[model samples]
Target chain A: MSYCVNCGVELDRTAACCALCGTEVCNPSQPVDMTAPKPFPEEMQPPPPNNRPLIAGLLAALLSLPVLVCLVTNLVFGGGAWSVYPIGGIVLFWVLTAGPLLSRKPRPVPLIALDAFAVLVYLFVIAALGGQGLIVGLHWYLRLALPIVVVVAAATLFPVAYLRRYRADGLVTSAILFVDAGLALVGIELALSFFAGHPFQLSWSWIVLISCLAMSVALLIIDRSPHLLAELRRRLHV
Target chain B: MSPLRKKSRPATAYAEWFKLDNAAKLYPAIHTGKRASMFRISAVLAEPVRPELLQAALEEVLPRFPAYAVRLHSGLFWHYFGHAPGCPRVLPDIKNPMLRPRFREKPGFLFRVFHYERRIAVEFFHALADASGVLVFLKTLVAAYLARAGGPGVAPGRLPETVYGPGLLDPAATPDPEEFEDAFLRYAHLHGPQGYREPKAYHFASTPEPIHTLHMVLGLVPVDRLLEAARRRKVTITEYLAAVYVDTLLEMQRREREVLHVDPRRRPLPVRLQVPVNLRRFFPTKSLRNFSFFVNVSIDAANGDYAFDEILPLVHHRMRLGLDKRTLAASIGQNVKPERSLALRLTPLFLKNLAIAEIYRRVGEPTSSGAMSNLGEVEMPPELADAVERFEFSLGPSFRIRTNVAMASYKGTLAITFSSTCKETDLERGFLTRLVRDGIPVKVESNR
Candidate 1:
């Protein structure tokens, strides 16, 4: 007997609110019959449970077995602590793959930070072990390697954070990423110059920076102009 | 002998295996956890459902539906159906019906029977049967249940001659070979050109509900008022409803454009609907297995803002042309010709699945914005009809399309149910409110 005043459709006797518009029933003549059976049952079937974390945990355990074997072999044979190499590599692999799988919602910024830290730890292990002719002890790691990893990680994290915060579409995301790439190249050149004990000067990176920045500017212009963006989408649609 | 008293046959009489029908071949390949090719048909009885009697009825009635009594099995090249080992148990209905069936699970059948309060619903995997076939299965199951419950005038020995219409089948009769035939292969003329590909259509943008959650909105309108509206317009009921749907979609798109601040001159994509036609009507076949095809009807906003009246004839004639036997047969031929390819038959099942899934994404999923399937009016003998109040039909969720419409009428009430995975009810509201505005009274209910 009751009708949704908003939708103009008759509401079911058991319905307390309008199903279409969510308007509360206020019929003075006929009150909602609470005891009447609902059109559908109240029981909800839960979705199947997710097995992703279990699988990821099993894979991580399998990965750890190799690290354990190498460590035991190195300790028993009395080798020069070479077990650190295998152990560090395996740990780094686990961080990159299993870390995201374990978390409920893996945010890009935190995952990237973890990965960058793992890379740095692996490099530090090599430096500490005095890698044969590859690393000049801690000096090369501190001056060149540390700064490059930091700059690259920062460059990667900036755009991801920006995109997530602003909810940017394809064009804006590409523009931001391009700008990050241009800045990272400049930072890498400066790090190299500092490591070589030369005056801070940009050289080969200038061409890359100019090209990347120009593309970023063009993309931003297209994103800002609705007419141009629509034209481009129509032309490039496949 | 009365229809209910007819002795039920044993399941051993059914063939052990069956090839997936022409239209059915795509569902198994593309079915996923989120996108299950399933639909439901239900009958609302006049009294509360007795679960025990319903179960007994299911056990008796299932043996009559051999096509529905099978489980999905994968072959080296294509998926097929094998006779299920046990009778599927009738379970209590859930708020969310038609979640994808786990074929490996206990009740290995591809279809399930459920009852809630006064309703008996059958949810079928589309690979098993289309809506028309499922409707017949549901009607028969309901008839069997009523006979078992021994409602007044619905005694096992007393039934009207008209009860065994096209929908309700005699449980005692031997399984019809015609019902199991792949009508597509039988009717296809392979030399005809393949069906043409259509341009991508526009879909509404909305927040998706969580996995396995489907929201259903049912709007019940009197069939007489709807039929009168269609009669005045000189179009069939399907065409009239489709025009109203297109008009609503047009209005929604305009509002979306305004909110997004898009250029007014930018041409909007066409609003296309996939209207499924029962091929059994056009061709001479009693196959209850998948024997249906869809016709895509569209209106482009780029042409101009079209009024409801303007869209009516366009949809009406398009449906008239699309439902022609030759057009349907050619579409069927295009579908069946690939199954006959020697190289395709030799391809591994995994590779074939990949190819079919890709084709569906490119061609099948993008061509229609949404689907509207009308099962039309369901008829029953007066003895059984008095025991039934109404019937309902609903489509399962689609991977790309968020909302789909299904219509079925029983007695005098037409239930137009909209099944959607999106959180927004704007489309359902617009559609139902439009009907209300057009002098049709709509009674709205939902499984919120």
Candidate 2:
């Protein structure tokens, strides 16, 4: 029942190597299971890790911490204002773009869509309830909220669809991620100054929101297909 | 449990780009964040002939090798614990009138730190220390020092001991202050590598992955036959092999695209290759640390569909022209000055690498397609045959780039082997197969 992972030649139980190509056969139940994994002998590799699940879980928790903190802060200090709802927006961003959710796996579209939907709902709730607390008008919400909504929606949903269909991936290279993160951080800093109680308010949260949106979308597209990234790395031929 | 530490942290605009660029600049990062597997090649020499004897004769080994010597001047000799030899410390001074320009207003650090044993190391720091200009030259100084430490003049005979490295670096050893970092290449604004950019190719937090290596021995015809073959080709053997590699690469690039359904337009990895050229061809130096400049030739993926034969001559031509005897001679005779200042030269290496790192972003992740170093012919007296059965060569990558080719001939046979620290093995198999197809029989001896 075993077949070559490469070339797909059917294998025999006792075969030490591919009868046709001489590639060592990896059939375990067969008498010649010993021929498996040759060429790349196991002794040459580093020790394998034992705690993959723990590692993944930890990474996921670490990524979501910022979102958790934002929620806590909003309920306590956000004064029941729709403005505080961006905390939900922030959390939504992480759920979609960060952690295990963002790692390489088969069919990431649906999973990503769910996170984006959650974030969108949270943002919508915040926008819908904006004027009730903590210094606000619908105009501020209109400008910032719409952008947040558009970006979050695009980042959350677009990449999933794009990746499912397989297209326009290089747009999310690590370089783009770097640029996005940097600009978003600065935007957040700048937004604080234009609104809120302090010289700068969470209005700057929009910067991170945008970065999160961009990064989420970009990573999804890249994950969908890394043809461009792989080509670049291969040419460097390092 | 506490959350795992994240190496990829969000950064502010300018800082983040700079950080990532610095990461890209490092040869190791360029190798995909892989750890460097250490290589130690040892060749035992004849018993304790006077150290000075071998050192004295080193200059005669090759016309292109650097020459310079180190002396403690007695009182200036520094020392560490239970010293069998070497100073606790000694400064590395500029030697060989040929190196006057490479030296700065202040004497270099190499002049200060003396080796603890008879060993004279030629080391290239893995971006953790001095800039390449200083480190490589220092090693050249060490090569020259080998000649000096051996003595005034070594008559033609076998070296008494082994002269190879993987020599221990005693972390606890104390030292005096003299430094490396060549005094060349002015980092100015309005030009690329603009205004004092640092050379420290930084990797934020991801530790390098473990590297795996397997050695192979392929016996071949003697150096004489290889030389004969080269002469027949009307090209240096180095050129011949380089052609083979270039051709093989072009083939592989084509196959990868077709098989993977990849776009054929873009070159796989857009890289700038650095080929070290001995400056000794330009200037006469009695010093071994000649401080050579690497000539870079990038593979143009845009020119992908082309055949190797078509491109081979162009590469051969460039390397030959770059190494032209008369050209280097003329530059050397010009008495050019060292490029940078002492303190200023060392500063960028420590602060942060901006341009060297942003290579991928600015030039499009321009990675080095590994490196090709044809040490060419390393001829010793024919009498040293039994002690040195066929010779071999291996080149180490600087910081960002891994994987390199080193070819040398000792016996009458011409043998070649490709070395890679990476896991993928297609490049090696493909290279060997093509050479065999070209009529050179490949007898792969399984060491395992």
Best-performing candidate as measured by TM-score: 1
Whole-model lDDT per candidate: 0.86, 0.40
Clashing pairs in 1: none
Per-residue alpha-carbon lDDT of candidate 1 for residues B82-195, written as tens digits (9 for 90 to 100): 988768788999988888888777657888889999999999999988988888888888888887786656776534566776678877667777788777877877777656
- TM for every model, in the order presented, reads 0.83, 0.46
Q: First chain TM-score in every candidate? A: 0.89, 0.34
C-alpha DockQ of every model? 0.69, 0.05
Task: Write one digit per residue (lDDT tens) for candidate 2, span B1-448.
Answer: 1111223222222121111111112432222222221221212222222334333333332112111122111111111011112222231211100011111122211122212123232322222222222333333333334333333233333343433221211111221111111111111111222122222121111122233333332223345544454566677666666666666566665666677786644346433344666553454332222235555454565544556566567667867776765443333322222112354335444232343345533432224455555554444333233433333444443244334555545445444434443434444455555554555544332122
Residue B251 shift from truth in candidate 2, angstroms: 4.0
For model 2, the stretches where C-alpha displacement exceeds 4 angstroms are A1-42, A47-118, A124-152, A155-238, B1-25, B28-222, B252-274, B278-293, B296-312, B324-356, B361-370, B377-404, B410-415, B420-430, B437-441, B445-448
Residues A116-196 of candidate 2 have per-residue lDDT tens digits of: 567556755665675564345454554565445445544545545654575443455443454455555554454445444
- Model 1 TM-score on a 0 to 1 scale: 0.83
* Model 1 CAPRI quality: medium
Q: On a 0 to 100 scale, what is the lDDT of residue B302 in model 2?
A: 57
Per-residue error for B261 in candidate 2, Å, reads 8.9
